[model samples]
Target: MWLRVGSYPDRELAMEMASKLRNAGVRVEVKEYVEWDLTEKYLLKGKLGELEEYEEAQEWKRYADIIRELIRNGMEVEAFEREFLKRAMPEEFEIVEKARSDEITDDELVDAVDAMMKLSLLLSSVYGFLKANGIEVGEYIQGNLPEDPEIIIELDDWAEGCEKVYYLDFVPSYEISVDVLSAIRGGAEIHGMEGAVVDAASRVLMNLIAGIDETNDIEELKNYAVGVIEDSKEFDADVYVDAEEVFEIMLRSLEKAGVIRISGKKVKFRR
Candidate 1:
């Protein structure tokens, strides 16, 4: 997917110019990209840290910090341990042991790529299913509808049953479990294939993406992104998220703050 910078009447001429630039050793490669706005206090940091160190530091450092901060703030020992320390310490040890060395195995890298591909495909299928069923989904940050798009985060919040904080909305969009996807890929027969599996997967997905919309300041977005980075560090899996993708969904908040304007993948200061 080529990122179109500007459009001219002559498409051939543009391609020719691009080719000439590449021939002139400009290191040109074309790829598609998405733009989005973020909210919360973490998404605006604009950097994805080194994955190895990120993994090691987040589990131990963040766990210790949260615990220490809580205690320093005069929180009760039992409550602090139960709420944060106990949960963080075990996982910290597990992640530190698993990610102690910097080198990643080839199989682990391949698994990460495969998992991403499966998720992409599943999102595409879900988007199609929802659109066919007459549930309209608008792009959350861009404030527009995308054509032939996958992974449509809703622009508005809606409640499903008693849950009031279902910000990401879609109908007939089955939130399948990672296990089901893994099972199917592993050639295992999905038992109770119809309603049971679908409902379970949907429940899992809902829980995973469930959060209330907070169209607050960019500071909040930065904090939220930092939390995600720290959380990723605690896990055993390898996740290499790009800096832009991390904050794109939160760009709307920046725009809402009257600081900038976003056009496609390009952003600029508001006049």
Candidate 2:
């Protein structure tokens, strides 16, 4: 038989309680004992000595509700680990205060969780698009979220079917270290031979199509694009364009004015 020091209806609260208790010289064993719903569950996260099968209690729903309320209000899950709650409940102390200088704040943890949830939904939307295009999508490895909260998505079976090289990172309206960008582009240039070829081909075609004089030879266009790309590589290619809104407006205007029209497999442009 084990002594029950505290009982939490959710795993988050239970884990915090166990951690705090252990810090304060208490021996406790924590485990999830019941599943109530996809989001809410009763966890038997306190006690010492014995591990036994436990069923959901009548008051489990009430405890779960309390935990959920705190979470919804943007409170850190560790807020439950406070000393007052430990002493007032009698069921749960002088908390062993650990240095929190390196620890992330409760607010930051909440924000990170919120960001990940939104990112998951966005990824689901993209999965739907891929499935619609007859691509088979499978479960992806979801590693621990980075501290900075950036989503890195790698798609398979799109266009190049995993044979193409593409590297693009969006920092979400913020500036990132130029050193990081340099490293990324350098790595890209090394492993992106296929991408370079593709880019060169597209640039050459655009140049020839938009030229004042008509050029019908594919070989000549390829040579020109290669020369231009190689020549331009030595110059600073880093450019910051703050005209995203302006570009959006231009795109809408072009669509409305029919300056560029897209019809299945064909794009018509006004000369």
Cα lDDT tens digits, model 2, 202-266, are: 34334433431343333332233323454334234532223222333332333465454434433
Q: What is the TM-score of each candidate against the true structure?
A: 0.17, 0.20
- Worst 10-residue lDDT window for candidate 2 reads 172-181
Q: In model 2, which regions exceed 4 Å deviation?
A: 1-21, 24-102, 138-271
State the displacement of the C-alpha of residue 172, model 2, in Å, after optimal TM-score superposition: 30
Residue 101 lDDT (model 2): 22
lDDT of 1 by residue, 44-106 (tens): 111113222333223433433443344443544335434552344454433323332333342
Give the clash count for model 2.
0
